[model samples]
Target: MRSSVAVILATFHLLLFSGFCNGGTVGICYGRNADDLPTPDKAVQLIKSQNIKYARIYDSNIQVIKAFANTGIELVIGIPNSDLLPFSQFQSNADTWLRNSVLPYYPATKINFITVGAEVTEAPNNVSAMLVPAMQNVFTALRKAGLHRRIKVSSTHSLGVLSRSFPPSAGAFNSKHAFFLRPMLEFLAENDSPFMVDVYPYYAYADSSSNVSLDYALFESSSEVIDPNTGLLYTNMLDAQIDAINYALMGLNFKTIKIMITETGWPSKGSPNETGATPDNAQTYNTNLIRHIVNDGGTPAKPGVAMDAYVFSLFNENRKPGLDSERNWGVFFPDQTSVYNLDFTGRGVVARPPDANNTTISNGTSWCIAVMGASEADLQHGLDWACGSGNVDCTPIQPKQPCFEPDNLASHASYAFNSYYQQNGASEVACAFGGAGFRTSKNPSYDSCIYATFGANGTTAAAGNATALSSAKPSSSTAASSGSDFGVPTRGVAFFVIASVVALLLYL
Candidate 1:
């Protein structure tokens, strides 16, 4: 009986450990202003496939929430600005909203954070005034549902909320907005929630390229701007921006509140006049930023602190109104392929197929393929573009050819997309067939299906009959492998508590 009891205790300990929080260095914003984006299921799959663990969505859309259920992806869902007045004016409204929108999908969906309003200080004063009240009501509702401990409540602000940001130590909020911000900061501190803020080095660099070195803004080279007050050395604009915010919080005497980066990213493409918004610059900025945060602690001012950051967006939002740069801040195209290869774990990008002798593929490796969740019609359309407009060889996928026996949209499109992807220097843009294609790390070759891939020698070949294409495992360097919260499996504490009680009763 004692032995059996010992085994039960061991199992209980395993359960508790499984529920412990996992850490992640990177998260992505899931913005859906574009109509051609993949279905929610597909998008979530893509996120998981990419080994992404944390995601922030603008609203608690039912489809999106339902899709994320049981996926272990921690979400920070939002309440739209329009709902602020209603949520704040009446506790019942907030309660009802949570009951209907969130409670139905609570633990299953892993909704860990709630943003009452985004950039409230940037809104009209009247709207900004409702922010805290709405947050309190939401928090109350979560408490009533007995979820306040797990699902945090907070709001996101633009750096525009700060009146001063230079000289990291001199950071201070615009005095005019202090009336609302001070109380908001208090609420965040009381609730143990973070003061979320959007920081964009891209904007800073664009506005004053002469003043900001491109290398410093991109987290490269080294920061020459040292704050005289703190005598701290700075290496990147982002760390400085974060320190500025920290200084601002310290100025207000709210030193205990944590900081969360709600959004930050560079645009891969923009209007002709939007200089430095090229793919190379975007890649450099995001890659280096990810590497810095993953590999190091906090900035000079707040060294050793582990900060939470979410990249601006997953896909370019075509319908969002603003400068061309605003719509182009996505790291991915709508088809769910990287705009550029990124190593979220601070390691360099690894090539596909890897070398025969070594596990890492050479830098020149590339492949083209249809995105997994693309529609049949979209797949056909993309295939057409690749063969006709893209001028990729489609002979292998034609009737009676090696690849034609599959007679499927995905197989044929993969062949054609791979061909186009290989021919066009295997660049990211080569696979974008209006959001129907993506890049692959695994060679998508199968029996009698001769897909094209760019080898290290810069030559293409039909590798004849081979095993069915294996799906690409996420690179070891992806953030998930290093223990992201999304990779953690969560079970309600109630389960463990109940199990312990039951085991005790049985043992006695």
Candidate 2:
């Protein structure tokens, strides 16, 4: 009898888990706009521990892509607004960007979506004119890479895309934006991509509290707001906002196009004016929202068709611009630690806010994992590369890949310096900040390059430059050795005289 009960309990456990593992799950958006946050690669581990399967990042951060690789988290990457015009005009440029930024960190990071632009139609402050053309160019590049189907192309919009959202049925784009938005919607429909939105009921409520009921905004009371046209009573504000988006699509004559909520969440804390931002409200809103999504209940407008939602963010960004509520919407803190009691419905997040107010990096030469003491000649070669002398050349991070000029050389140089300064934790963050031109930057990751090429005892430097490199000196810290390296820490040997001096002083 005991054995039978045990077997029955085990079968029930499997059945309960089967649906969650097999079916599609909603993803969380981990926006990295903060000044202090862990490198993207490390962040991936945090998300995995939470059992998060999907994510969407604003731009293609190399660190983010490299970190998510092999982590089984599906990513939806974006191109910043600035790149739209140039990228639209040059397919080759897009290709090069992909090879340098996207290609290296593939399969390991299952990047699923390529967001073309952000709310181009209502982009009063951005290059709204280049919106469609940029989309076309990015789409073309995906096709050339033969990744069009596997990786989609779309854009997220602010609900402002609609001229009138209150009535739902009376929705339409402003005539000024119609020329761009109509064609864009047509493309999305033909391509089968979602019209993503960055929806926030908090914004509406904050904009006007007297009119928008706090209970409706918080999803608290049982009261409802009916859509004037559909007469569908909305018990919560978020659904009403979503239905407004659906009606906007319908008015454009592409009713079949799918709509997705790319960003949404309630802030845990905020200023006095942001009344709906209380902890109780946050719990009510998020708890109810998750339950809403879990139930897979569609809005009255599109009943039964499960909506795709990506929670606004993973961490509260201290550096974000706008109201206090803007930065307080994160589900986690800078350290990948959860801010509240979010269950993740069976998931969790871990984070390490990268050092803040850090200007100079730790001495990198001290950080090298040393190789066995090499001959005098080898040391000389390594020194030459470390100091940036000419003639030495080692394999770049990307092997066998033709190199392309980075977006800006000066920026890359600064990044290379910072990356080495931060050493162990900031490799990916440095790369993302460094952009594609990172290695070639004047302050290049010359030391790291050399370390990778030679042995950690700084073997590769000698191979890259014929002359002396300036930075890769021996020191106290060391990189963890990869493959066969000399036994001693490279830093210890390089700074032998200095170490001895410090030791003598301490003893005295």
Candidate 3:
């Protein structure tokens, strides 16, 4: 009996370890704005195939919620901005919406959260005023249904909530929105819901290239920007964005509220003069950024806590308004082809074989992530050798963690040409080796890539600025290892791309 109990207990422990929040999480916001998009059922298949555990859709599309049944993907549904008045004015409306729209989907679908509004503070006029009341009413209705504990209430915001973000330590929320932001912060803090921010480093860089270096914004260069007030230095834009949020909460004395990035991405395509929109820069930005998150160093403001990020979008939103970049934030194209590359634990599934290696580009680089089968032992091995810790065998086999591409490196010209060749029946040579993935052909315009970033030590990032001199590109012989490795070669000519980027940095 004792032995049997031990076995049962061990099994239970294993289950809990797997079920409990053990570590890093990868997710996406499935925004279906285009008319020609696939059905929700097909969408579910795509998300699940990519191993994405969390998804945030703009609305509570019943079809989407129903399709996710038994799939075990966590969801954060939303209440459209238009529903605010009715939801806030009548508790009954909130209850009915829950009963009709949510209750039918219940535990079967794993509806973990409901965003009451999106960027209310950033919204014009009284929209900001109505958000909190609606959120509260929604909370009450969920409680009456006894679903409050199971489902958290929250909202997403834009970085415009912060009045000043330059010196991260000195971050502060705009005073105009404080009336609503304060109580909302308290409610979230008490309820254990995270504060979400729709942060786009690309926008900051695109709007002000004179002030924002492409490498610093894309996690490539190590130019430090100091906040005159806080006396803190920020090496990258993402880190600065997070620090701005942290400082804002601290400024409000809501320092304990969890900060979650709801949206952040680099556009794969954009208008000319959008200085850093090239594929090489896009890959480098995302590749290095992913590497930053997979490891221990949280934002400099929140050390020890693993950062939680949902790469802005799963697909390019062709229908979205605004400039060209607005519609190009997807990691993949509408047909489910990856736009750039991403090297990390998180990778999206491709419906067909790409012609070459790819990356999770946000619009500035062309990096490659490791193949999905990468393990921590492999990562540690790479880190050991790369950092001169002397643990890696430095063998010619696959690397443990995903490596990055140099800032201006062009693994492929543009996808249009590759697609042309693929359509013409030349798929083999079309697959080139590089960051995040091996795809047919990539657009010359987009170079941003996403790859793994591991800390040399448990506490600090592996010397920020992946394109720095310390990060040398491997040789060409190694670069052409095999077109089949969807991930890039961490040991060849690709490695020196970082060195070249660093050489460029010296001149910068």
Candidate 4:
């Protein structure tokens, strides 16, 4: 009985922690193949300012690794294709590389993954054969340093390795690449590492725009494509592409391994022949992609399975040898200004129309509050920014203070957001929060907890609108649907708590 209880408790804990660890996450690829880009230290600041928690660098540049030390940003570093042969031929080479490139600044740098080679199947001089050997050598070296379990060792592949990805269900690996891919998949499964791949819906649509609808590629599709074999309805091309990879993995009986999108993005500019590459399309794709990932909008094949992806990339590389679109995939320019405004937090819509003076303005009386269904993580991000960097006085929402009764994420976030909004002259940009907040004409004051409003004189109490606000209370639909108080339990925390109790009872 004790053994059975122990097993049950172990499984319960695994399930509990796995859910938290695997929650949908977004990372940016820090590709520095440009002449005028900011230095690594400045780049770190830029990433933090945007609330970006994860970043991937193509190589283990000492300067870049040093810059990330103690910044709390998880990094995915890489090994170039040229080094694969030496790493594969001798374990000592891998050990030396790790000692010089990684070991000295590991835990401080937060290096989560070390990709052995990127897209080896596409590399020249038949490097695909060396991919698995290189990964094994790297893993062995890390194990020698007692770091194998902490930093995952793997390689990234391009979609060119797949023979067919149509309808998603019929996905399969190309026969030629299977020799290396099979062992690689087995290694990933055995070590609990993710199968990294670069997925580009933009390439698919750009290559065959006649067949792929712009709406589908942009995640704006109203219709769905039903897979005849599995009856899975795919609403967007990105999900379908991921599901296709999932199906391919399943075909090889590697169902335990998860997929990580190492790179995915749309370009803001392109050659005339490039059908759908434009600033608007790029913005729409990335914005929707962030929203989808952060919301845990899993593909139909793996519903509710939170996946992590890295957007490519942080800045456009002027020296990249390709079409104009190739050099224009960045969300930001070298100057640190956004190529276009993006909400890295994926909380709210990120559309800002500036006036003639290039400043955001508000037309009428509006209050910025947390959106009804915003995720707890997103709400917390917005709240932290509002109180800290946003320079909002968040005293009223603290313990034993006004507006502290509800004591929930939504309520506190609403208070903080409104405070920031009112202080910032009620500009539309002030309420953006990457889409976590919305401008509501409805006054959200109730009882002693009063929201502030911007006035010609200065900040003023919203009590003047009390009579009008009485009829307009924030809806409790989100809380009721979620079976939590004020929608506070996010990402299935309540469910995990209940499961924990049941497991404890069984153990007792």
| Best candidate according to lDDT | 4
- Put down candidate 1 lDDT per residue, 184-296, tens digits, no spaces: 89999988999999999988988999988888888665336778997787867998999999999999899988899989988988888788887767876876677566655
Best candidate (score: TM-score): 4
Each prediction's TM-score versus the true structure = 0.66, 0.62, 0.67, 0.73
User: What TM-score does candidate 4 get on C-alpha atoms?
Assistant: 0.73
- Quote model 2's TM-score: 0.62
Per-residue accuracy of model 4 over 52-89 as CA lDDT, tens digit each: 99999999999999999999999999999999889999
lDDT of 3 by residue, 222-277 (tens): 35777777666667788888988898888788877887777766776777766566
Cα lDDT tens digits, model 2, 51-70, are 67888898988877888877
Q: Report lDDT (CA) for all predictions.
A: 0.76, 0.60, 0.62, 0.81
Model 2 misses residue 419 by how many Å? 53
Q: Where does candidate 3 stray beyond 4 Å?
A: 1-23, 228-231, 343-508
Candidate 2's C-alpha runs over 4 A off are: 1-24, 121-124, 346-508
Q: How accurate is candidate 3 locally (lDDT)?
A: 0.62
Backbone clashes per model, in order? 3, 41, 84, 6
Residue 482 displacement (Å), model 3:
32
Between candidates 3 and 4, the one scoring higher on TM-score is 4
